[model samples]
Target: MNEAKIFSYGSIPRKGDRAKAYLYFKEWVGRFFEFDGARKEDDVVRVVLLASLNNGYVEGSAKLLDLCGQTVRNHLRYQDPSSFLQVNHELVDRMKRLGALSKPLTLAIDWHDEMYYGDPEAEGVAGTRRRRGSHYAYRFATASVLLDGERLTLAATPIVNEPVIDHVKKLLTQVSELGVKVKLLLFDRGYYSVDLIRYLNSLEAAVCNTAAVSHKGVEGRRG
Candidate 1:
């Protein structure tokens, strides 16, 4: 097993395990992704990740990274958002090959909403429930592996006025294609529909009608 290198004051550039992991991950993503009209794809991706993590605009993140925000914005604008499926496939494959995955994952499938400030008529925009300020938001379904102390998302797909089961099916297929076995599936109440519940019940994994962190057991589907 590889252990984390000790931080040394002797080095001019101090990169601990976290920094090393980030740099390595960035490099891996850069090698796989070839963004259109983007010569500096690394910078673009960095800004995008930073922006997403902080809930800040990508342009703002670019400015912080000392890059041309407009250029990064344009590159990001032209990229296909659905292309993440392939990347997740590669990541899961790599992890499995390297024996990094714990067997029989307890997965959680849930909805994610990115509140949109733009026009509601825009493509890929869906209605946001339980919100007065933002009626329209971009919705996504994400399947995540719930380990002892960590939650790792396996796959995500965009949802624009489609049945939750359809998106859930896509994630399940993606995860299954990666050859990761799932023992239990914890689902959010938003995805609590007749079709989805029936589908989960049919799966080899036991279905839990609760979140990953907290569970109510596999008694039956909850409305």
Candidate 2:
């Protein structure tokens, strides 16, 4: 039998013949968890246990539905080499109906200044002093346009401290596989970077409608 990975938060089972090592991934801490079989590497076997933490803290064990099992599935399929990914707009619509998602597929490299809560009457309803509001660095890819001028989309979680390069890489990898094509990417003056532009170009994606005044040559033109 293939070695299996046992997942838990605190410690390994004491009575088991061998201890299974389960590490907590930064993305999935408390929301959902699963056991995956081990893979052979040289002379040893290694297994990965993934978990998604709930948005807010609770007294006891999280309810089964509180965890994002589909998120876990997406994560696993993404890691597989032979798998193909597709982002369906219909699926996104269904998620919206279920109130699991909101829309506006923009990526934010910086932090926002707003407060999020499960209850409107909760004590701290105003903006927090500790953290800014949530923003999207990268979100979903879809066959159909998910966001319209009247619609605003949102990310599942706030993306902070992540470089644009890494975000771009992940977006290109997953979105392309999902058959979602973006004709142009528009951004403000703050995102202007020669390195980022060049990288996007390498992937055959153009960086359109970026502020041009930062260049010395452009400055001369204003005169």
Q: Write the per-residue lDDT of candidate 1 for residues 129-183, one digit (tens) a residue.
A: 5464887788777788865566778887888867667888898887777778776
Candidate that would win on lDDT: 1
The lDDT of each candidate is 0.67, 0.34
Clashes of 2: 13
Please give, for residues 60-164, the per-residue lDDT of candidate 2 as tens digits: 212232443334344444343222121133334444655544423333222223445345444424323433443211222211223533222222222334564
Off by over 4 Å in 2: 1-161, 205-223
Candidate 2, TM-score vs. the true structure?
A: 0.31
TM-score per prediction, in order, is 0.74, 0.31
Model 1 residue 191 CA deviation in Å: 2.4
Residue range with the least summed lDDT across 10 consecutive positions in model 2: 41-50
